[model samples]
Target: MTAPPDRRIAAHRPDLADRRLEGLVAAGQFVEGERWRIALASVPLRAAPRPDLPFETEALRGEVVRVFEETIEGWAWGQIETDGYVGYFSADALGPLAPEPTHRVIVPRTFLYPAPDLRRPPREALSLGATLALGEAVETRGTLYRMTADGAAAVVDRHVAPLDAPHADDWVAVAEGFLGAPYLWGGRTSLGLDCSALVQLSLAACGIAAPRDSDLQESAVGRPAEGPPRRGDLVFWPGHVGLVAADETLLHASGFQMQVVREPLAGAIARIGAPRSIRRL
Candidate 1:
């Protein structure tokens, strides 16, 4: 029989004992081999099956993953569809494989209400980039009812954009909205984000594809910009990166400040030292 595809994140994970998995796979009992969507606001993709394990990536609400295996402990081994990131998540976090997403959140954060009225308490807060399936438009109430992959229903403002819609040609403008978000090493949502995540999210909203890490990002969309720095350019250091807010201002989710913020490019250069290169996406 053929072996399971080698997922980079799953490589060398000691817990994935080859003999045990191979036996199950050869017997046709290893994986469910189904597609699913994330039902929660965010879920950790852990290195191990347990919650105590460290996570290097996350699955955002409404994103799809293809299940490769399931454990009795209720964990699902899978590969994220967006970037092919692989890991394990709680089985409870998954919902039925969804139809194509119809709309995407454009704001940093917003609430999903139980009904169309703002007077009612919100069911949950959805972070930026969460997608929704449009249900019904109730213009008079200034809200739109929507459905999730799990068949859950909620109402939100008409403020969302079509799923395929691009915010604009300038990616810098998209990055600016994340100002003040807390820094998280592998986060990509508005709840907490890292430098590469900020860049990825910003470019993604502008309909550009970006890789997950600083070095990968540097290799992906980067093209050396002629002349000095300018707005919308990307500046890379050894292990870090940031967006050019202007000719002299830089925006990034910095570990130094522990949050996303704007700082003078010269000051950042003086503190963080010289950038490896400045590229325009």
Candidate 2:
């Protein structure tokens, strides 16, 4: 009989596989792009492009003002603030930040950097998100700095808003994608990557500005003022470096190993024989 046709044929599933990014993707975009993120609740922008760079790093942050095509790449768009300097950026870089009347605060809280991986610490660290005694904290490049309760200066890689108001699980999800990137001297993109570049760019994509080198990255920010060890921070040995993990673990593009590898933080420190320092930034 013609009962329910033949059930053996596969129907075409286009939405999941046929999706096209709305802009020009870089050579690595198909594999390396971070998807489904939105900028934090605040940042300044304009309705028309100003005489400036359109995307932070070196330009002004722009809203998704308009989208067009260049016939060479893919979708071409412009971001204009209240002022007018139009610049071009790819559409794939666009997240879901609201494209509406822009807002500027007198005491501006967050500032995005060229490096995309920086972020604010999670809210558990802040004592009451509202109605708390707020004090002045400074930012370098795009990371935040704070003075200790006992009058000491400290810099922290953000894990909170402005950098991002990330939910708890987001950090771990992003870290997984960085596993096999090749080691680079000062490279930060997907091709030949280095330890600090991995940390910096990963955090930068989250709207965090991590310093570029191992020595600078390891200098500040983490749980202990000084450490036996800590995770999600950088570990340093004389002329060598790696990132720390929860299990007294470390990740680095080691010269001896000659590639990105993970090892015990204690073992790495012992092998290096008295590390010069550890930076939490």
Clashes of each: 0, 37
lDDT of 1 at 190: 82
Tens digits of lDDT, candidate 1, 54-142: 66677877899878778999998887778767788899989866566788887778777665667778877777777777665554354
Q: What is the Cα-based TM-score of model 1?
A: 0.84
lDDT of 2 by residue, 1-281 (tens): 33321111111111211013213221222221122211222122222234243222111232233322222553322322221222344444344433321221111123322222245333211110111112246666775654222222232434222312442333323443555656655433344456655565445444444544455555533433365566555556654656666687777666556556677777777777776666654
Highest-scoring model, lDDT: 1
RMSD of each: 4.6, 19.5
Off by over 4 Å in 1: 1-32, 140-152
How far off is residue 213 in model 2, in Å? 1.6
| C-alpha-based local distance difference test score of model 2 | 0.39
Question: Which run of 10 residues does model 2 get worst, by summed lDDT?
Answer: 9-18
Q: Report every candidate's CA lDDT.
A: 0.77, 0.39
